[model samples]
Target: MYIKLLYSAIALVACTSARPQQLSLSLLPPAQQVFVQPAQQNNAIEPSINAINKPTNPIVVAAFQREALLPPHMQNSFYKNPKIAETLAQNSWFGPGEQHAVNRETEKIPREKIFIILKNAGLLPTP
Candidate 1:
């Protein structure tokens, strides 16, 4: 099939070479020819930034609480499951960052990046 396609392309090029054609090109209009510019800038070009509504700790606390409510056997798997662990750690700024105070570790890896890596590795759920 590829050989036939290649042959067809070669035939097209060969056929086109047998004829001569002229093509017309046009130059762009000068700045003066363009529409008049507006004097005033748009009032609201960007959307306002707002803080996230839910605090991060409650979700983590909820997950732990939910796990505690589960049977002892299920609790082990709930906590240990990589997907659950990674989801609970979502950092899309996904959830809030670092709950506890920390001064050490100069280059802290964002949880979103960690979640991305785990998601790529099939350890976390992929959207």
Candidate 2:
């Protein structure tokens, strides 16, 4: 009972004495200014939206065409394939274990590279 009373008293004191953490922006070091030069304009004309959308890689273009031709029901099965799952896992920047599998930057990598990856894995045939 005495120990309990002591603990309760200690807890009360601790609670009463505790103060919220205070932060001031003035206390922080000044942020360094980084100046970026404006990008130079090129004389070359920009590609049209059609050209941008179109797959330049033959293998990717053929795969896309084949997928487009498939019925809606078949299209569902194509995406759900285990081989595609494995390929996605392999292509992902992060993996299950300690291995840093950021082999390719996800955003920057083209769809053609993914198609090529699938083709090399024997999931897709060469076009």
Candidate 3:
């Protein structure tokens, strides 16, 4: 009986410990490890001040302004509906003039530029 119990215990332990084998290595081809030359490293280490100093491209700035200002849902909605896009495109400011009258009265800034201004002011997130 004791031998049978021992054998059962051992079998139980073995069964519990058994696990499926896994692949040891990735299927992808081995990556080539390139050694960077010292001269290349030195050149790359210093960024060009002139490159950083360059003025922002107007088109890129406008695109970024558009990206950073509009919410993802609004952006999606605008893209989905031509009428919405037309309305948005036609308006200089968001919403009817009545809702944003205070903003209009307080800041002489045009409604079209308000989104950008609000984004710059940290009131809104990038779309």
Candidate 4:
């Protein structure tokens, strides 16, 4: 029984080790050639070009203006310094009692940038 098992294993090994016959490409039909046509240049002016380049929405323009005014902390809060915020609040023309209000406004600056980023990334729903 052991000899029969060994013979069967050897037969299995021999079958597995045999090289598979490869198909000849020469025997197959020739592939058809494809020619691509060049794109035609249009002389007509585009209707959307002006609209795409122009800032029609005042709200979006305001948002961009506010983005430009925002401090560096809004984009990179990892390097945020509390001392800078306090200093800005102190130097502002607001009264001493309004220092906290100034600080709060400074803190709020990043939220606009954060919301814009999140909305652009599709992580936050747009209003």
On lDDT, the leading prediction is 2
Per-residue C-alpha lDDT of model 4 across residues 1-127, encoded as one tens digit per residue: 5655554454344333321111111212113222232232232112221222442333333333444445545644422366774565346444646432212222323333433333344443444
Candidate 1 residues lying further than 4 Å off, grouped into runs, are 1-55, 76-79, 82-84, 87-92, 95-127
Tens-place lDDT per residue, model 3, 38-103, is 233221223222132544333333333444445555444444476774565456334545332212
**What is the TM-score of each predicted model, taking all chains together?**
0.20, 0.20, 0.17, 0.18
lDDT of 1: 0.36
What lDDT tens digits, residue by residue, belong to model 2 across residues 18-65?
221111112221132232322323321122222224323332333444
The 10 consecutive residues of candidate 3 with the worst lDDT sum are 20-29
- Candidate numbers, best lDDT first, in rank order: 2, 1, 3, 4
lDDT of 3: 0.35
User: Model 3 — TM-score against the truth?
Assistant: 0.17
User: Could you tell me how far off, in angstroms, the CA of residue 35 lies in candidate 1 after the best superposition?
Assistant: 69
Candidate 1: 10-residue stretch with minimal lDDT? 19-28
Q: Write the per-residue lDDT of candidate 1 for residues 3-77, one digit (tens) a residue.
A: 555544543443332211110011111221232222322321121221233443322333344455555565466
RMSD of each: 25.1, 26.5, 26.9, 29.7
Pick by lDDT: 1 or 4, better one: 1
